[model samples]
Target: MSKEIKEKELIIIGGGPAGLTAAIYATRAKLNMLLLEDQILGGQVRNSYTIENYPGFKKVSGSELADLMQQQAEELGAEIDEFDMVERVDFSGDVKIVETNNYIYKTDTVIISTGATPRKLPIPNEEKFSGKGIHYCAVCDGAMYDGKIIGVVGGGNSALEEALFLTKFASKVYMIRRYDYFKGEKATIEEVMNHPKIEVLFNKDLVNVEGNNFMEKAIIKDSIDGTEEEMPMDAVFGFIGTEPKTDHFKGQIDLTDGKYIKTDESMRTNVKGVFAAGDVREKEFRQITTAVADGTIAALQAEKVIVERKKNQK
Candidate 1:
């Protein structure tokens, strides 16, 4: 005998803030919703040590905030399943089908909130030293390297911001940029440039990383003359950027030039009954507030679409 395919009114493809917020709305709206999370429910935010900008809470750890959201959604009757990797999704038919490693679900509407992941360099020893010495998420690892010298790669706003943040713990921070100029906002660039603990290295490329059991050095090549130099570093952080988690949905939905899901202001995708929110959507700003707003809009719109479809059937 085969396992029964579960049917739901709405299926959320992630369990981050956006997906959790959607669950809160969907369940309150009396929609039978199911949220699928491949890993921990907090997504990338789980790694963040402290978040100060989110309203209501002055400051809170990412894990704590996520737990609260998950608890609220569950109390409101949202069905959340974790560690279920979605292997395939089919939105071509009237009823969207999501196939996971364990089960298949037929859902009336699908909301994609699968967020992005950090993009790392393709250096020769980059992978080898990932956890051993190289690191990402300064919040998670900064405290471990107190008073140690660190190297930060990239010249964007995120890189600069993280470099500054690391200064609170690390004794020295080397800001490595491939171009001669910084690309971040003027204010941020100025602040980082004027910071006493940050040493800016322009026109440099991270060619290789080396360490015995842990990272101790990084090899950099000058972009202008290609002269190579080794920098003594305790740990290296990559704040380059992030890549959207839409590889599984490729060719199934329209995407923007950046490969993020193309959604309208209402969070509706080109395909009917399909919606996207959070960092996965192609939008100007991607923050916790924006992600929450996107989730609210997508859930309300999904409810409206379901009602309209029912009326048409009648």
Candidate 2:
């Protein structure tokens, strides 16, 4: 005899702003929902020390915001499962199966809100000095380099953005780029170039990071020629790019560029009854506010699907 299959109105993967917001909306719509998070509920926002740009709150700690969102979601009757890593997703059948390390969750509708991860620099000692002197998120560890010289690797918008933000504490900021031309927007590039505290290095690649316990210096090679040089610094920041976390749903859904999921305006993926939101979806902006908006839209769409499916059966 076959085991009885459990089913839910909606299942959301991830517990960040996107996922929590979805739960809030879906629960309010009277949809039975289950939210699963690999670690804590907060995603990248939990790593941030301070968040000043989020609306309503002029200034707030990342942890505080996450706590408030989680509380609100729970109050709305959404079930949250933390520290559950999803191993696979089966969306081919009418009832989706989400397998985690501990249990299997079945749902008629699914929403994926997994966010992105920091990109690393491809250089020697880069991995070795990760905690020592190398860093990726300036917002998380910028305070430690107060009044000290720091090097930022990359030539994109995020790289320049972090360098500009780091200038508040760092004595001097070195912006290193492998190409002479930066790919960031004109405004960001111009602002960083004109900043007196920022020194832009063109056609330079990080060869290695040298230091013990703490970062002391960085080895850079001229991309055009074979000339190499060493630059003294207290810390190194890498912002080359970001990679979306969508590995578990490899063949279950359609992906854009094999990274982000392709979704319509309503956050509906190619597969019916399955949706995606946050940085995992293909979109122009990846901000917290935009991610929350994605969550709201996805949850509403999933709720509609659930209601219609039940109505059709009756």
Candidate 3:
């Protein structure tokens, strides 16, 4: 931590579509803004192999979309600091304090777009073989499983897409789902079902991961029956769901079920000068377009409040 404190009109956390969009809007508003990301820019968007639903382009890769958004924000004069981990935050006072690994930021308003992270299984030995074999990101670790067999857990769009993506490297891919039917787009579900290398194991749940240094097999149980089977695999991937990255903001603002920040249509949380957008907030839809829309609304609303305060002060 640095003793030097930096001041800005607004501070945006996370570098996903939501955070980058907020930065773009704040820059156009001519307010001094700074964006901080704990790791590589784009957040979870980087894990997506391809994004077909986002507007404008009929089809685009996740990395490509993230790059375009990041480039646009930078060209519009948004200052961004990547790989800056936010250690803690204080939003109780009017002037919010955002403390990262390197610096402490004091700002009139804060936009929290930290987004969400992939959910992992609570099975046995999951911690021991986390990076060794059990992986969460297919794009990040799929190449290592070339010609090897792997299992994917979840039934959502992410799980479906990852199952197909892993087919490029893994000789055999098992898509294990707790439900009989998948909960992804119809087209994608059909694609995964029809893929030759991908096998769908419905009504199945992962019970444990077994291995010495690296994962070698998995214990899967039939959700309907009590029958369990051992399936040999080199690696396993999970895309079941996501948990909000709001640990730092906890107790500082209002949160809903599952610790998601609660905000109105304006994206304003319980805190007066603090707002949350994207997947971090409680909402039904957590798509890229929705996240961007949330970011836009939050930025505009925050700007309105700040401008009003300055005018009143004058």
Candidate 4:
């Protein structure tokens, strides 16, 4: 059974850096705000091992940073509800409505910061060995493969960073990429190329994954030579890319071909009173700093929308 409908001045749909930042700003602006997170409060950041880019902290664990953000938001009077999965959203009326598993939320403004999720490699036995052996987060599973061999896929910054991190535990790491050249920053690329524990394999695609109870090996195809080889490894870490969690907003908001929400510079979506931020929105850059900036802009804009709406009613 569904719970009673609750009303608020603002509701943030995610609990990551973006949503938490939004909550902090919204509460400081004196807006009645509620944050909903279905899973862990940290979102994807929790899967991260270390974050050195976020200013103010020389080096902080992703989980620690997330906990700090949540703490600050709560201390500042932001109401956060974890494990509340949103069932649906309605933006047809003047007040945006969000229906979750337990409650229906009616809000003057809504900020969609439900960030992107890891894009899985569409290989045979991939889903079967998700937790068994095929892991997406190196931080969460890297220790399990101590003194073992593992394959790290993708040529992006995240993939490179995670592979480097895995080297601390894994005996040897195979860094695989579908492209000939690394797409990450020059410095990171150089580090990965020079790392003694890492072997860089370019123009390779993961075609199949095989395992018994857990992942044992993966099949890779050489795009350049059309040759196939079996890479023996304990586990494979896929960091190919990510897809935005915007399926719930279909027909409710404008989106790009990649399914990212379309928003203006103010982070306002096409739908009035609705805004998008973080990795969920279409933008060139996707980083913790960018997500925080998006949240701040969205919350301040949402404050404006709420104040204007109240004035209209008066």
**Model 1, CA-based lDDT:** 0.89
Cα error, residue 71 of model 2, in Å, equals 3.2
Model 1 Cα lDDT, one tens digit per residue, 167-202: 999899999899999877797799899999999999
Clash pairs, candidate 2, are: none
Candidate 1 deviant stretches above 4 angstroms: 180-196
lDDT of 1 at 25: 98
Which portions of model 3 show Cα errors greater than 4 Å?
none
Pairs that collide, model 4: none
lDDT of 3 by residue, 1-314 (tens): 34679999999998899999999999999999999997888878887888989889898999999999999999999999988889999998888999888888999999999999888888878889999889999999999999999999999888899989999999999999988998889999999999999989989999998988899999999999879999998999988789999889878998887989999999999899888999999999999999999999999998987898799889
Per-residue alpha-carbon lDDT of model 2 for 240-280, expressed as tens digits? 77788999888888897848999999999989999999988
Alpha-carbon lDDT of model 2: 0.88
Residue runs of model 2 more than 4 Å from their true location after superposition = 1-6, 49-53, 57-61, 143-147, 164-169, 179-197, 212-214, 223-226
Models 1 onward score TM values of: 0.90, 0.85, 0.97, 0.97
State residue 186's C-alpha deviation in candidate 1, in Å.
6.4
Candidate 2: residue 176 lDDT (0-100): 86
Runs in model 4 lying further than 4 Å from the true structure: none
Clashes in model 1: which pairs?
A: none
How far residue 49's Cα lies from its native spot in candidate 4, in Å, is 1.1
Listed per model in order, the count of residue pairs whose N, CA or C atoms clash below 3 Å is 0, 0, 0, 0
| Worst 10-residue lDDT window, candidate 4 | 41-50
Residues 106-167, candidate 4: write the lDDT tens digits: 99999999999999978878889988778889988889989999999888889999999999
